[model samples]
Target: MELDDVDWKLLDLLQHDGRMTFTELAKRVSLSAPATTERVRRLEQAGIVTGYAAVVDPQRLGLPIEAIVRVKVRSLDTPRFRERVVALALVRDADHVTGDDCWLLRVVCRSMVELERFVEQAQRYGDTTTSLVFSSHVRNRPLTRAVVEGTAVD
Candidate 1:
């Protein structure tokens, strides 16, 4: 579906706050609640809106340690190693990357001992180099209408 300015605005608002009520969204886009709801449904059907989720704090969840793990896998066992890592619950996100490493994993652990054990298990499949994350400066920035239009807006 071709997205108009209103559709883009709706998407921008939803990206910032997925739980925003249909009435609130309608007010922002100057459309009726039903119209806004239909637009959101169309966005979902078009695969423009994939999913919604709540961002949880790892520290609050008792997982205080966060680390980035770069893994170097043997070419022959890459597929098998990938399946293994994907099944691991501690791995929040994993990416297939270039360079000396084949994959990068973002993981959360409870403590240094827990991280060490996770590393040991991960090393069975590939060589891993891990670095602790101090903080995230920016995250989950919303895409504005200007961004989609290839124009500039603050």
Candidate 2:
């Protein structure tokens, strides 16, 4: 489905504030509330707007230490390794990756002691290379002008 200028604006606005009301959204896009609502529904149906979620700060919630864990698993242990990773509550994100690491995990813990415990359990699955994240310089970037131009994101 081809998206128009209003559709692009709607997407951009929604990305910034998912909780914005349909009336507010319609005002920003200069459309009737019903029209904006229908457009949003269409976007959802097309899998463009997958889901709305509130972004939370893990550090503020007590999970201050963020670690990037690179895991290299044995071929025979892949299934068990995945199950173990998924079962860990501290694991915020896990990616099945190429190269030396079979999986890359983003883990957050309350302290060094907590991180050490998690790593001890994680090592059972594979050889692990872990790095502590000092800070995030760039994250959750906004949609680019390409979307407004009706071009695919690079």
Candidate 3:
């Protein structure tokens, strides 16, 4: 909700390292451990801090092939397509985007053959275009107050 400078600092610190203990977080934000815990709990209750997760490397897990698959779903197949996409294990992320593509999917596979199979399955719903991801400059950058307030500059 109404976050002060201390809250913002706590958010920044937590985003960088979610595993940081309450004592460490309190020290960084200049608050007591109990205060820091209370603030973090409030943030969670307010839905500002959604969840904590570990970021893993796809390549290290044997799913090196990454692809962006854009699909323009057929009018009648929209519901079915959405359901099917969710069940797809290879789809790491899916966005219902505007413009030419109805759905943009971030898919990862073990090899080109697996990717091709995924494309074939997607084609049943509508026209599909797939592109392999060569590199990613920004994967998951932490959000800060400046960025959220539109005051951040590159």
Candidate 4:
């Protein structure tokens, strides 16, 4: 789908504030309320604007520590290992990457004790290194320009 400037602006605004009303969104992006509503609907129909969500503060809600775990699998060719990684709940994200580490994970945990337990469960997956994230320099945002350009993101 070819997205124009208004579409891009809509995406940009929505990413920051997902609950913005159609009227307010229209004013911000300089579009009529009806037009903005229609565009958003189209974006949804095309699966561009797939879904809306509430952003939760992990820390404020009790989950404080964020762990970056680097995992080096014994065999990348092993399908079982891949399956295990995917099925693990503590594994927020699992990627087969370069260098010594075959997979990297970004996991959220309540405390260091929980993080240690997560690591222990992952011990069978080869070697693991865990790092705690104290804070983020930039909050998680969205792909504003890509929505406008109608291009795939990397």
Candidate number achieving the greatest TM-score relative to the actual structure:
3
Largest lDDT belongs to which candidate?
3
Which regions in candidate 1 have their CA more than 4 angstroms from the true location? 145-154
Give the winner by TM-score: 1 or 4: 1
lDDT of 3 at 33: 99
Q: How does candidate 4 score on lDDT? A: 0.81
Model 1 TM-score relative to the real fold: 0.90
TM-score of each prediction = 0.90, 0.90, 0.96, 0.80
- Candidate 4 residue pairs that clash: none
- Candidate 3 residue lDDT tens string, 1-154: 7899999999999999999999999999899999999999999999999999999999999999999999999879988998887468889999988999899999999999999988988999989999999999998799999998899995
Tens-digit lDDT track of model 1 for 8-125: 8988899989999999999999999999999999999999999999989989999999999988888888777777775689999988899999889899999999899988877887
| Model 3: CA > 4 A from native | none
By TM-score rank, best first, the candidates go 3, 2, 1, 4
Q: How does candidate 4 fare on TM-score?
A: 0.80
Lowest summed lDDT over 10 consecutive residues: which window, candidate 2? 144-153
* Residues 35-129 of candidate 2: C-alpha lDDT, one tens digit per residue: 99999999999998899998999989988899998888888888887787746899988888999988898999999999888788778877999
Identify the runs in model 2 with alpha carbons over 4 angstroms from their true place.
Answer: 145-154
- The whole-model lDDT of each prediction reads 0.88, 0.88, 0.92, 0.81
